[model samples]
Target: MSSSRRLTTVGFDADDTLWQNERFFRITERHFAELLSDHADHDHLSERLLEAEKRNLRLYGFGVKGFTLSMIETAIEVTEGRVPARTIELILQAGRDMLSHPVETLPGVRETLERIAGTHTILLITKGDLFDQERKLAQSGLGELFDGVEIVSDKTRTTYERIFAQHGDGAARAMMVGNSLKSDVVPAIDAGGWGVHVPHELTWVLEHVEPPTEHPRFLAIDHLGELSAIVEAIG
Candidate 1:
C-alpha cells in the first residue's frame, strides 16, 4: 500500500460475511428438489436450478424473489411444462419462508465490528434486493454500527471506487472485507483498495473465482475475527 493510504474506511459485505444467508437458500433448494423429486433427480434438478440462476442474474438481479423464480423456472423446465400448479405454489411458499427466516450473525461479527467501528468509518456494501437487505439489516440489529449502507444491484470495480471515494478518502485508503473473492476481493483490489477475503462455508457457485494471490493489495483471513488486526497493521 502507498504511504498516502491510511485505511480510513472499512467496507463490509453483508450476506454470509456478516450473517447467515446462503444456508436459507440451500434449505429452500432442498425443499425445491423434494417438490420435484418424482419429476427430476436431485443432482439434475440442482444443476438446472443453478443454470437458471446464472441466466436470470441480469433479469432478476440477486435476492429471494429471483431465486424463487429460478426454482419455478427449473421445475417447469424439468417437468416439460407438466409441473403441477400446487408444486409451483409450494416453491413460492418456500421462498417466502426464506425471506422470513431469522437472521443469524456469524460468530465474532458484533465484537469485531465494535472494536473497529470507533477507529474507522465502516460501511455496509452489499448487492441484493433492496427491501430484503433492509429487512435483514434491521433484523441483524448490527445496523447501527455502519456509518453508511449501500444495497446495490452488483459489485464491480467502479462500485468500489465510487463508494469508497464518497465515504472515505478514496479506494486506496479503503479496505473491503467479504467472503466472495470475485465480488468482494478482486473488484475492490482492482479499484486500488485493499481486498480482504474472509471465506464463508457456503458461497454461491456464481461467486466462485480464483484468488488474486499475486496482487499486492490482496489478503485473505479465515474469519472476520481476524479483520481488525489487518486494519491495524495497515494503519
Candidate 2:
C-alpha cells in the first residue's frame, strides 16, 4: 500500500488491455510479409515496413488503415511501382478485414469490469485512430460499462496530466490500468496518480519500456480478474 486514501476512479486502456487487438494486426503483417517474400527478403521487408510505420506514426498516427496504406506504399516502392493488382488488393483487404472483424474482449475483462463498476467511476482511456477505436468500442459491448471514454491521438506525459486534471480532481484518488508501460504506467505515475499494470502476452515492440521501481502507487498483475482483489487490498 502506497497510500491510505482509497481510489475513487479507475481508468482503463482499451486495446490489448481489455480486448484482443494487436494479435489481429500481427497476423495481417505476417501475411503481408509472406506476400513480399518474392520481391524482397522477409527481414528486409519487415525492416522497411517497420521504418514506414515509424514515419507514418507522425503523419498518420495509429490504426489499421494507416498500417494498410503504409504496406501498400512499401509494396509499390519495393516493386518499383509495378506491384500486381492482386497484391494491392490483399493489402487493402487486410485493413478492411480488421474493421469488419468483431471486437473480442479478453477473457474475464467484462466480468472484472462489471464487478468493479459500482465501486469506482470507470473511464475508458485509449489512444489511436478515432474511427477505428470508436468502431471497436461500439462492437465490444463494453462501452456502456464506462463512465467516460477518451480517444486520444497520443498518450504522452502531458496527455496524462490533462486527463487527471479533467477526470481526477483528487489526484491521490485515481488509478490507471493498462498494458503499456510507456503509454499507461509511466505517464500515469508522472501525473500524480496510481497505476495498475496488467501486462499482455504480446506487447508491441514500439510500446515496450522498462517498469518503474516498487512504489506504493505501482502494482502489476497478470490479468484483469486480479484487479478486484488488488484494489480491495490497497483501499
Candidate 3:
C-alpha cells in the first residue's frame, strides 16, 4: 500500500461474518428436503433447491425471502407440481421461523468490534434483504458500533470502491473483513483495499472463491479476534 494510504476504516460483512446466519438456512434446507422426500429423493431435492437458489438470485436476490421462494420453487419442481399443500405450508412455516430466528453474534465479534471501534470507522457492508439485515443489526445490539450500514444488492470491486470512498477516506484507506472470498475479500483487493478473509464454518457455496495468493494487502485470519492486531500493524 502507498504511504498516503493508511487503514482508516474497516468494513465488516454481516451474516456469517458478524453473526450466525447460513447454518439456519442449511438446517431449513434439510427440513425442506425431508418434506418432499416422499415425492422426490432427498439428495435430488437438495440439488434442485441449490439450482433454484442460483436461478432466483437475479430475480429475488439474497436473504430469507429469496431462500423461501427458492425452496417453494424447488419443492414444486422436484415433486412435478404434485407437492402437497400441507408440505408447502410447512415450508412457509420454516421460512417464517428463519426470518424470526434469534440473532446470535459469533464468538469474539463484539469484543473485536469494541477494541477497534474508537480507532477506526467501522462500517457494516452486507448484502441481503434490507429489512432483515436491519432487523438483525437491531436485534444483535451492535448497530451503535457501526459508523455506517450498507445493505447492498451485490458486492463487487466497483461497489467496494464507491462504498469505501463514501464512508472512509477512499479504497486505499479501507479494509474489508468477511468470510466470503468472492463477495467480501477479492472485490476489496481489486478495489485497492485490504482484504481479510475470516473463515466461517458454513459458507454459502456461491460465495466461495480462491483467495488471491500474491496480493500484498490480502490476509487470511482465523477470526475477528485477530482484526485489531492487523489494524495495529497497518497503522
Candidate 4:
C-alpha cells in the first residue's frame, strides 16, 4: 500500500453500486422460468440458465443481449428444441424491456459524488456492453459527476492500474467504491488502491466472493452516505 494514499482518485462501479441493476435481472429471470415452467422446474431452469450465462460470458460479454441469448439457449436445452416461438418472442421482449428500463440511482449516490467532485478526481469504471452501460449512466443523471467514464470488457488488476493512472494520480493514490467484492473491491485493492465496499441489497451470484477482511486497504460500509466520511478521514 502507498504510505501517502490520500485518495486522489475515486472510482465507482455502476450497476448495483450506483443504481439498481441485478434486481432487474432477477425479475426477468423469474419471468423466463415461468415461460419455461411446463418444460422444467424453477430450480432446474434457474440452474441451467445460470450455467448458460457463465458459459456464454466469454463470447457475449455482459449485458441484456447476452443474458437474453443465454436464457433462450437454456430454454431450448431444457425443452429439447420444443420451446414455442411465442416464448422466444416474449424472451426477446423481456430483454428489450430491460434495455429500456428506467435507471434508479441508489441512496446518497448523487449527494456523495457531488460532495467529492470538487475535492478529488472521480472516475466511473464499469465493465459491460458499451451501449447498455452508457444508456444506464446517461439515465442515472450522474454522468457529469465523473471526470472520466470507462466502460471496459472486464475489470482486473491491470484495468484498475491503467484506469487510475490515466484518470487521476495512480493506483496508490486512488480508491474504488462499489458493491461487488469480486470486481469492484478486490481488483482495486490488488492494484494497491483503497477498496471501499458499499454492498447492495441484491447481487449476482457470479459477482460474489469472500470479503478481504484482513486487507489494510479494504473498508466496507453499509451505504454510500458513509463514503464521504471515509474519504475525509483518509485525507
1-235: candidate 1 lDDT, tens digit per residue: 2345488899999999999999998988888888898988989999999999999999999999999999999988999999999998899889889888889999999999999898888999999999899999999999999999999999999999999988888898899999999999999999999999999999998999999999989999998998888988988
User: Per-residue lDDT of 56-106 in model 3, one digit per residue for the tens?
Assistant: 999999999999999999888877898889988999999999999999999
> Looking at model 2, which ten-residue stretch has the lowest summed lDDT?
1-10
Write down the lDDT of every candidate, Cα atoms only. 0.93, 0.85, 0.92, 0.92
> What tens digits encode model 2's per-residue C-alpha lDDT throughout 135-232?
99999999899988889988877777777667655546778899999888888887778888899988878888888867768889989999999877
Model 4, 48-69: lDDT tens per residue? Answer: 9999999999999988999999
Backbone clashes in model 1:
0
Using all chains and alpha carbons, the TM-scores for the candidates as numbered come to 0.97, 0.93, 0.97, 0.97
* Error of model 2, residue 85, in angstroms: 3.0
Clashing pairs in 4: none
lDDT comparing candidate 3 with the true structure: 0.92
Candidate 2 is scored at a TM of 0.93
